[model samples]
Target: MEFKNAKEARQKIREGMWTKPTPGLAYGYTQANLVVLPYKYALDFFIFCQRNTKPCPILDVCEPGKYTPIVTAPTGDIRSDIPKYRIYKNGNLVEEVTDIKKYWSEDLVSFLLGCSFTFEKALEDANIPIRHIEENKNVPMYITNIECKPAGMFNGPMVVSMRPMPKDLVQKAIDVTSRFPQVHGAPIHYGDPKKIGIEDINKPDFGDSVTIKEGEVPVFWACGVTPQAAIMRVKPDFVITHSPGHMFITDIKENDLALF
Candidate 1:
């Protein structure tokens, strides 16, 4: 299920042709995390993202009642562009669907947040293996003890995605990813997941665990899913988000986001 470009990939997803995780598709293009909330909570969530840029770098924010991410993927519909979506009501997950058109409303605001997946092409180019991708599984994610800077009613433990790479490539991976700060920059921690309150590296709070090969260390990065943690804690009345590992592919090229 390879595609020529981001648009094609998005179309496939839009038409229900692809429902799996989006990692290996649309290579070299930027991918994003989705967060749709009511107009009332939009401001608070935006502030939360501003105060916690590492885990919630915003790529584009649609106007209230809008679904198009004009800046990143103008032709795309946030309601169906993502392969999968999660619906939450009063903090409880109510359903997982392929599209949210039925849930659309004028009071809803959609946000496209920078995703670590955006930098994976840079990582692959550097020859640093992405373990979960290699294993055909979702990247392992954990909710850390580190609390994000509180903003309004939004605050919770930071969530991080892990990629197990050889000990030797750790520095190289950091150097490569550091150039793309808009997509979570670089590895925040490596070697010990316990230091971040992960009691079991084999069991992640979100996504799937992968093989941490011999001589490989688990590298962690700030994840956009951090907002979901806050949503659950705050128990907002209604919200929608892309399922973990499933992302919205954007028209922007991956290299375009690099600081270098």
Candidate 2:
């Protein structure tokens, strides 16, 4: 189904019409990663994002117990607007739900983090091929040897999303993405996934793998999923996050976040 705007897309998700990974939907609008935590852990997590801007760039944060993202999408409800949500208890993923209204609490806080998906439209506009989008699959993501700066009880390896493109377009891809710092600007690593601790490019820690065509090299970008890695290591009592590749579409436009 094609959506004319972010609001229409989010409404469909809220009504259970779309229950898959969101990549090409709401073209030109921003897409965000979600992290819902208890109020007690909010400050520390916010600081963690501040220290690791590439992977955890803040888009909009809801007040404790609030589900609406007043800044990014005022009409959207974080609990129901996302296609899928992961529920974690003691850091273990316990359930994947379409909506989190049942888990709502007065003590929980919602954070919207910039997603790489937001910059994909720009990449496509520049004639850069996005493999997973072409294959109708989720973007491949992996945990790396790169450790994030520790913040309070949160500290873990950075997670990255990979896209393989023609070797010649690597520099152009970097230039296109570098303009959007809020959506993980630029490629962190363009070749040799092993150098970043990825044992096998085919087996990603999250999301799905796509074809790496001949003459193409895999490029990696800091992923918003990094917080989920920290949540797993820290084993917080309870938390909620958007399922990998399932993001919340926002009313904000892509160019609004670009440097130029």
Candidate 3:
């Protein structure tokens, strides 16, 4: 069944009909990265996102003990709206679950972070190719030497998602993406991966690496998955986040969140 909007998509996911990545699900709506942490780490994590807005742009934050995001989707349930989730214990990924109802807690605070999928439709409308979508795989991502500013207990290297494109279209890609600053606007770096400390362009730290066609360059953008890196480094007692490529569908439209 084709969903008419983000709300419908979330309903299907919540109903267990969808348990996969949410790249192109709600075509014209904004998608988000899910991050749930104990209240003890809430203030610090909030600061971490504020300090590193490019990769961790805040879409909406649910108050402690609240499971629904009043700002993004008042009717949506964070614990089940996403297709899949990753549970981290003491910084180690312990399991991947479809529903998080069994892990809910009053001390847990949920953060909805802006995701790049929100700008993908713009790219497609602009005729820019999305290699990962074309290949039906997750976008290639890497941990760069670039360091994000630390906030309280959270700190780690910046992680970036890469897309390959013709040299001439690089500028167009940038212009289209720049319109959505709330969703990690624009490519942070393009061309040489090694310069960014990516030892191998073929081996991504997360997601699957796609082909860089002849005469095409790899363009890197700040990725929402970056928080996972911080989580691993900090090893908080408990954390729940959308598995890479799995996102939370929201009711907000793409243009509603566009800066543009």
Query: For this target, which candidate reaches the highest lDDT against the unseen true structure?
Result: 2
lDDT for each residue of candidate 3 in 1-99, tens digit (9 for 90 to 100): 568998889999999999878777888899999999999999999999999999999999999899989999989999998989999999999999998
Ranking 1 against 3 by TM-score, winner: 1
TM-score of every model?
Answer: 0.99, 0.99, 0.98
Error of 1 at 41 (Å): 0.5
* Per-residue lDDT value at 169 in model 1: 95
Give per-residue lDDT, candidate 3, residue 54. 98
Better of 2 and 3 by lDDT: 2
What CA RMSD would candidate 3 show?
A: 0.9
* CA RMSD of all predictions: 0.6, 0.5, 0.9
Candidate scoring better on TM-score of 2 and 3:
2
Q: How many residue pairs of model 2 clash at the backbone?
A: 0
Clashes of each: 0, 0, 1
Write model 2 residue lDDT over 1-260, tens digit each, in one string: 99999999999999999999999999899999999999999999999999999999999999999999999999999999999999999999999999999999999999999999999999999999999999999999999999999999999999999999999999999999999999999989989999999999999999998999999999999999999999999999999999999999999999999999
lDDT of 2: 0.97
